[model samples]
Structure formats: C-alpha cells, structure tokens
Target: MTRRAAIEGKPVGSDAYVALEARYGHFTAMQVRDRRTRGLDLHLERLESANLELFGVALDRAAVLGSIRAVLGDDVRDASVRVYVVESGGRPLVMATAAPPFHLSGRPQSVKPVVYQRYLPHIKQAAGFPQAHLIRQVARDGFDEALLTTEDGVISEGAITNLGGFAGGRLIWPDAPMLRGITMGLLQRMDVPQERRPLKVAALPELDQVFLCNSRGVVPVSRVGDVELRQDGELMARVIGFYDAIAGDPLD
Candidate 1:
C-alpha cells in the first residue's frame, strides 16, 4: 500500500520544511489499529513531558489527537503513526503522520552488543545519529540489530527497543539508564515479577530467555553476539497474550 503522511495539517512540502529537518525534536510511535492505540494516554504524556523539557512549552493533547485523527481520516485503520514535536522559528510545531503497518517478526532476532549510550536516556528524542551509526556498523558485521551498553559492559537497551529477559522464572530488565518503553511499562503492569538490575553482557548466555519490546511488539532474541539464547515458545505466548489483552483507546 502507498503510505500516507502529513505535516502541520498539510502535505509534506506545503510549508517551510526547514524545521522538520531539525534534529531538536521528540516523537512517539504508535501502533494504530482500527483508529485506536494502546497506552494512548501514556503516549500523550510522553509528548507533553518531552515538549516541556525540550522546548519549554506545554503540548496540547487535544490538538495533537485532533491532528492524528484528521490525518488518518476515517478509513485508514491499521497504521504506523508518528507524532513529532519540533522546534521551528522559536515555536513548537506538531506533525502527525501515518504510514504502513510494521508487524513484529516472530522469528528470533540476532543482535550484537555495542558500547554506547544515549545523551538523554529518559526522554525519547530525535537524536538518531549516534544510534544509527552504531546500527549501520553492526549490520555490516552480520547482526540484525545493535544492543546498546555502557562502557563498563553493562547492557542498557537496544538501539530502538527496550531489553528484557526471563531469568529464574521472572522478568528482568537492565538497571542501567535507558528509555522506559511504553510496551515495557504495560508488561510490568501485568503482574509479572520484574527486576531492574545491572546486567552484564557476559552473563547473557545464562538467561533463560531474552526479548526486545517496542511499539511493534515483543520479539524474541535468539543470539546476542556469538552466544545463543533459548527461544521458548511458552514465554513468547505469554508475552503476546499480555499485549493482546490490552484495550486500545479510540482516537476520536
């Protein structure tokens, strides 16, 4: 399907696109299924919080939702939606767009650990140069994605997803600094025993199972560097069940 996108309530080129090119911005990706999305409130909260921190302005929740609804119209149901709050001309401009859906690959994902960390690990910003560079380098070395870590060899998160794993019959997330993904938050709310502690890259082989969670979904990790991990079907089923049970909020 041809992807559809808009900026500031008009086509991409209708306005001075200089601001859109700016790296000083924050965005949130949502899986819009049937014009609804899970954790819609959380997404709005993220945008609001980032806007205040990055641009010293409050984001309008109603206006942002309105823009998303208007851009999606009444027909497009399932889409990959991204809302960008960029600083341009000393003002904050909100741009909402929808593209084709990107579902999770149920197959195991291979990742290589990289010694890197984000600048503002808390807020989800548009600073993609560092991570992108790392990802490109790792891809060329025969890895599906890059797992970011600290210089001390502590696993933090993936280039684009949050890292979690099953250890000793519990879900364990890294204790290091990283963006708290909405999907991870939802999974934690499911009453699962979760732990946030420093995880060493050398200890990955000892974990029962590992996965990557993001807006797309929970994806199993088969290999981290050269060490292979267990690909448990039971764990994948439970994760999928937890996410599938989440009720989506309507855009309208």
Candidate 2:
C-alpha cells in the first residue's frame, strides 16, 4: 500500500525519515472518505488542546488542515491520516501522513488488563512506550489489546481506544482518565443513554457487553482477561447503526 509523509506541509524525502525520529510528538488520527471525515472539528480540537498543553501555544488549525490536504494531495481522497505536532530542536513542526484506510474488524476483541496508566491521559501522547510494551506483552500472552488500569484494577481504558460497557440497554464509559476520542465524542452527542463512572476489571462480568472505540470505529469485546463477554449483538448493532448514520463533515 502507498503512503505519504510530510513535515510543515512539505513532502518528506526518503532520507528525511531518519531526521523525523527526533521530531516525534503528539498526534490525532482520523479516517477520511472522499475528503470528508466524521468529527473533524473534534479531531482539530484535540490537536489544539494537546498543542496548548504540551507547548504552551494554540494549534494553527488552518495550517494543520492545509497540511492534511497538502499531504493527501488530489489523487488521495480516502485514507487514514495522522496530524502530528512534531517537537523538533526549535519550534514545533506540523507533520501529516496518509496511509491506506483502516477500519475495525467486526469480530469481538479479547483484551488483557494491565496495571498501567498513561501520563497525561487526556492527550494522545506521541510516545506511548508503556502502552505499546504492555500490548506486546499481552499479545504474547494471547490477548488482542492491553486494557489500562490502575494498580488496584480500576479500568481506565484500552491501550489505543476508549473502553465502554452496555447493560440494561444503556451504555457506560469508564470515568478514569483517558483520551476523549473523537469517535466516542460523536456518539455521546447523539441521543444515547450513557454515563461515566469508575469501572473495574471485576465489573466486566456484571455488564452484558463491552466495546472499544477510536477513529477507525467501534467494535465489541469478546473477552477481557479470562472473562468472556456476553454477546450483545443487538446493542452493538444499534451502536454501529447510530455511528454509520453520522455523516462525514467535508474537509473542503
């Protein structure tokens, strides 16, 4: 699959990849279809908030959008895009990358809980070494994704997505600190019966269903640790229905 990379809105050469290592920084991921995206405003707001919190300056929304368009170019209209505020030697730089479109597999996920929490959980940190490490460790142990939790087993979120549960025909998101994902935000805006509160690994058995959400989309979880989740197909189908009904916002 073809991929493109750029820094400060200009294409990066093969040799430039090495230099970008030091420029790695915070970012927000999104999927674009026909130059349109779901929750584009929320994605931009995430970048803006992260930029301010990490660099003490507001994100250049126009410049970032232009960079995304520039990197995507005319030929590439549908793809997975990531907008990064690269912290180089001097001032931060805007980097954008376009890759093959991605989507969550409808298959239920199996997650393994780990006693770990990301630093500054609100922002999507560029370096998620701990999360990545735990994911790898759990994968070796036969889990699909790592579920982040406190030392005492308080469920916070998934390594790369927001975690939630459904029971009694209502949804509930963990109250613990985690990135406010764009996809999750969009669902919250719609007419849905949901609430947030501290969730624990032990509570998984109580909920009729579990799910994870990110830019790629939402999917149900089949298992967390040794506990197999109940198959709440109707609830999940309704969620996907609501999500699919959300029209993409035009990038232009």
What is the C-alpha local distance difference test score of candidate 1? 0.83
Tens digits of per-residue lDDT for model 2 on 1-252?
A: 377877776777624634553354688899999899999889988988889888988888877888788778878889998888878877777878788999667878999998887888898877667777888999999988899999989998888888888878778999988888999898897576889989999888899888899898989999989988787888889888999889999877
Q: After superposition, how far is residue 37 of candidate 2 from its true place, in Å?
A: 1.2
Which residues of candidate 2, in runs, are more than 4 Å off? 14-18, 21-24
For 12-78, candidate 1 gives per-residue lDDT tens digits of: 5323334473457888888988889999878988899999999888997766887688668778888
Estimate the lDDT of model 2: 0.84
Count of steric clashes across candidates, in order: 0, 0
What TM-score do all the candidates reach, one by one? Answer: 0.93, 0.94
lDDT of candidate 2 at residue 175, scale 0 to 100 = 91
The window of 10 residues in a row where model 1 has the poorest summed lDDT is 13-22
